[model samples]
Target: MEAQRDRLVTLCRDAGIGQAELLADTLSLLLEGARVSVQSVGTEGPSARLSAC
Candidate 1:
């Protein structure tokens, strides 16, 4: 998880995002939530809105 976060931060920074850390954290949480949603409610649930986020 730490490695993934670090990589996300690095990618965000490379893209010149001002709040790289925050964005990385938000993306991590969003992805985790989507994964859990998919498992609990199937692919047609809230996880399907991920592309809209």
Candidate 2:
């Protein structure tokens, strides 16, 4: 997971995102929340709603 986060950070940096680490962290949390939401409330849960943003 750490390696994947590092890779995401690199990608974000390459894309010129100044806050690459924050982007990576946000993406990680979003994914984790989606997974948990799916487990707890199917696909159309709060995470899915949040992702629509």
Best by TM-score: 1
Model 2 Cα lDDT, one tens digit per residue, 9-51: 9999999999999999998877677768877898677777766
lDDT of 2: 0.85
Indicate the residue-level lDDT of 26 in model 2: 91
Count of backbone collisions in candidate 1: 0
Candidate 2: the clashing residue pairs are none
Model 1 gets an lDDT of 0.90
TM-score for candidate 2? 0.69
True-vs-predicted CA distance for residue 9, candidate 2, Å = 0.3
Candidates' TM-scores? 0.74, 0.69
lDDT of 1 by residue, 1-53 (tens): 78988999999999999999999999898788887898899888998898566
